[model samples]
Target: MAPRNGYTGEGGSSVISTDLSHGSVESGESLQSTSSPHRCHHVMRPARKVAFVYAATGRRFLGCPLSGPDRCSLFMWIDEAWGPVLSRSLIQLWDQAFLDSGRAARLQTKKKEMEQAYLELWTERSNMEIENQQVVNKLKTTILDTEIKMSRRLEFHTKMCVAFISSAVTLASVLAYVLSAH
Candidate 1:
């Protein structure tokens, strides 16, 4: 954009001056000339840009280097034509990329869902293992209790049998002595 005082160029072409970019004009840096009538400041040289819209991707254009509301309204294409076949190919490739990106997004979501399901199944398996172990421990404890009770009963029965045998032997000896005396 031109400065408030404007820049007068050779051949009597004077550009309307209020649009200088935020750089000092005395830096002595030269700017490249443009095909338009607008004069460029040192810092506001015409910038080459590429279009990325569908078939126009890779097409180059020249516009004001400074970007803002008050910038000049100059833009021109600098790229050669892509012809009908290449243009169609570029459009088809762009469409394919769009479709593939959407598919990739869906696949990513599905992968996350599968991972979540696997984690839940793993947690459930761990819980079931814990419960099974608890049941086994309870069964072991009950078996030990039953064995201790049976062992105590067997010991009591053994003592009673020994006492009965001792009393019968003593009674037989006493009966023999009485018969001898008579």
Candidate 2:
């Protein structure tokens, strides 16, 4: 039997008898033909024009029509019984690519942050070293000043002792001369 919409009986077993001539079959009705020729004819349909966009690659595939097996592979229908398999695959790939890019960016940012922190730490360490050197210089100066003051005090003490000895000698000589003259 001739299928509706000018479909030659190419699909599965026809609901109507296949022995009957093509013109005898009524339109808009299934056939019951078990013959391989009729079944092949029923299965074969004109390829429809389809356009698909791959989400992952941002690429478009045009004029690619899906067969019966290809239609079953897709999870969702695109439109007019077309499968969204290619589109869905493209979308998944695109999502993965975006995620990878995001991860890479985050890592790069983190690395920069770490480098900045390291530089700051180095600067602080250098400043501390300068301050330490200054402190050492001040300590050395204080020590030198204390040594000079101690040396001056020792010299003054030595001069006082010499003057006292000279005075004692002069007193003794005067007593002896006066006694002898008397």
Candidate 3:
């Protein structure tokens, strides 16, 4: 005989396992049953991380995901305590190590930023130095051009002065010859 879901015969001892709402089954057809067991599936939630203070003294633990009505009442300690003093000291050391690593990471970032700024400043300084050299070259060329112009002007003035002196000397000698002949 197959298992039944509800009460069936005489003293209610005979149970039929198939659902009667889907279809009616006669007593003759009870021997030809093909029903499976009732399986209840429950979803398992993951544990949550929690920090305990006071008596736990800043320790960490994993608690059940549920609370209130459907709580699974699950709890597990992440940190094991050696003793009060030693555990607190270890926790403090771990905290300090974590803080130190964070500080080191921040310092590394700042160092990179400073290095990048320094590189930019160096590049700008190099560009400025090149610009200054170009300006100096342009100034030297301008001075050279001005000096050539000035030298040419001086040469022209000197030739004009020599011509004026030669003309005065020739005119004076001719005037003296005429006066002496008279």
> Which model scores highest in lDDT?
1
lDDT of 2 by residue, 1-182 (tens): 12212333233322222221122112112223222222122253322222222231211111112333342121211133224785576557546756787899999999999999999999999999999999999999999998888888877777777777777777778888888899
Cα misplacement distance, residue 182 of candidate 3 (Å): 5.1
Candidate 3: tens digits of C-alpha lDDT, residues 3-71: 223323322233323222222112111111112222112234333232322234333334444443464
Q: Kindly report which residue pairs in candidate 1 clash with one another.
A: 1-19, 2-19, 2-20, 3-17, 6-17
- For each candidate, the alpha-carbon lDDT, in order, equals 0.59, 0.45, 0.52
Tally clashing residue pairs in candidate 3.
5
State the local distance difference test value for candidate 1.
0.59
TM-score of each: 0.61, 0.48, 0.45
Stretches of candidate 1 off by over 4 Å are 1-43, 63-75, 80-82, 166-182
Question: Could you tell me the TM-score of candidate 3?
Answer: 0.45
* RMSD of candidates 1 onward, in order: 12.4, 18.3, 20.5
Residue-wise lDDT of candidate 1 within 1-182, one digit each (tens)? 12123333332223222212222222112233455554445345565444454555555555565545554555566667678987898778667876887899999999999999999999999999999999999999999999999888888888778878887887788888888899
